[model samples]
Target: MLDTVCGGGGVREAWGWWGRTLGGPVTGPDGAAWLRVAHSPVEKAGGKLWTGPEDAERLVPEPVPRPRLRLVRQWTDGGDAYKAELYDRVAGGTLASGPVLTDAPSLPVAWWSGLRAALGLLSAVRTERTAVRQAYLDRAMPKYLGFLDGGGPVPTTAPAWSTAHGDLHRANLVGPELGILDWEGWGSAPAGYDAALLHVYSLAVPETARRVRAELAAVLDSDAGRFAELVVVTELLQSAERGDNLALVPALRRRAGEVWRAFDGR
Candidate 1:
């Protein structure tokens, strides 16, 4: 029998207790097993403490098996699917998307596959009619122009438009099977959006970055400039959506200047 409790933010806190009850090890790629525990302020006491184990059954409605031993706790508010995708309970070797690029042999196949996927995303975006483009542009262009100079190379003129994951950063790609997660922000973008994100994340290791870029460039038949522009635009939009975190504002400003230069050359 599952018990349930209702409160402001104690849902996650209560769920942790349930994980402890199962006695299963929760691990990530780092090989360290740890439990995700949550603590919140006590309503009346104005203090925080660990929610007791008794509250576990109440907080989680039913136990749902995923790739790991995870419990699917549904919120009565809405949606049939639970809010979280917990995978720590699983014993498989986890591979994070970005960092692993350095460990591998820099296979051309991986780069080509990723490039094809990126182009596919861009193609979807281009299929939109004038009105749809204007709608998306209206919401996206203001933020985009802010990153560009007076005259800039627009990503729309690129030769090979492809679908993009929009947010193809390292954290989104994970696992040994290279399963992509966090589809909420996905959409069609530019050809190089995924490659650029992957490249930027790999800046720490120059060798890996070079190899990945080479692989990507090799797969494309034409217009590297257009693909690169798309990457810049996608990254700029991502920065805006993320509240322009990580000093992206200045970077966007710089990219705008670069785009203007590129436009002038064309």
Candidate 2:
């Protein structure tokens, strides 16, 4: 069992339970110590949570000199927020990537690697007993149909589907370790979902964004043009699912046209 070393005003009760479970020394981010027991991660249906199995399989943990740690507690009866052990605090950091993007020339390489990783996840899902492909198509097709009817360009036939990180972005990706967190929406999804998500988020940084798109296109080869359209459509669908925030809808629509035209060689 693990004890998260972080706590605040309302977290005391949760921490108490955590301490009781771990029955061992537990530290908080503030350096407060306690005792607790830990339990193995489990899956509960209809619960919008991503835990051990998904993370263990999808992510390749970067080697660290010391053990990577996290708070061993889940959202309990209290509220939605998690009470977790926090370790290896990096200082002097800001959440915003700023207007200027990092000179990550290897972003293409990372994109290629990520695509392969995404494909690997898809292969694993295919091996599972459940008909995962149909499940995704069921969800994906409706969105595509709606967008297409609304004059948005999108691929009707199935592209590729796989387990996706759903919200892959640079902020969620930590350096050196390449750790991805916030797995709330992790699940089986389309091949280009994560890559598209990352590309959208990286757009603020022109060079990084270009590198991501180019790399993805390069990897897909002749299919790159069609895949690029799929990427834009996926972003629009995801945005609509989150909330019908109309702010970026026009931009996405414009991009969809651009990608479709490019793919059709119009």
Candidate 3:
């Protein structure tokens, strides 16, 4: 089916696209492009139209430095599945660099600079839901503040929210030029939400985690940022309980304990 979309460009490389979508860098007959396929009746199809590259290309103004999504076209199959052709391939590929399980990427300073620039630029985006609810905070506050689950000190109220990338992990980012992808959840979240999420994802790699925290200190090292980090840590703990990445449990627990200590000190 992808062959028909690109009119036949041999697939150069492919990667799992957020569970429901498929297609990677394709050498199209016309040129290079990416193919994204999804079945209808699934989760949100055409989600990228609003949150992915399209939204960035349309909404984010120039000097913002986001990858432009040139939508070639799209068609729906009889089964309600759809496919779209797009261009704007990243040279450095994903920030994950290689196999997700073993990758320990060493990003350049330029990467951090570009990322900060992009994040600041994205703040201009507005959404209908001004105040986004964070579920992680609900579970984390009790455990960290030592409440009903145990008993210690009460946590402060959640800090203010801001427009942010809902998911910002190494896999969802591209480097060299520093482009962010996987915009399925772009909206108004807590100010440091994206940075916190990325930091949590990197907990297994101490150096990388340290770099992430340092680069995002403006967000991760603040009262609001601490609150955000707790939320992400709780989410990771929940994932561990669900039998997802059981190996992540120890690191997550350690981080959670540290956050609790910090909260107690304050």
Name the top lDDT candidate: 3
Over 149-265, each residue of candidate 3 has an lDDT whose tens digit, in order, gives 223544535676777776778777887677776555577766777778888888888888888888988878887777777777666666566677677777777876776666546
* Candidate 3 residue pairs in clash (backbone atoms < 3 Å): none
Candidate 3 residue 95 Cα shift, in angstroms, is 2.0
Clashes of each: 13, 16, 0
| RMSD after CA superposition, every candidate | 11.7, 8.2, 3.6
Off by over 4 Å in 1: 1-75, 78-134, 146-162, 175-177, 200-209, 218-244, 248-266
Misplaced by over 4 Å in model 3 are 27-30, 42-52, 83-85, 97-103, 129-157, 264-266
Summing lDDT over every window of 10 consecutive residues in candidate 2, give the lowest-scoring window: 13-22
Q: What is the lDDT of candidate 3?
A: 0.65
TM-score of every candidate: 0.45, 0.54, 0.81
Tens-digit lDDT track for model 1 on 138-179?
A: 455555655454554344444443444444554445433333
The lDDT values for all models are: 0.40, 0.45, 0.65
Descending-TM-score candidate ranking: 3, 2, 1
> Model 3, poorest ten-residue lDDT window?
145-154
lDDT of 1 at 82: 21
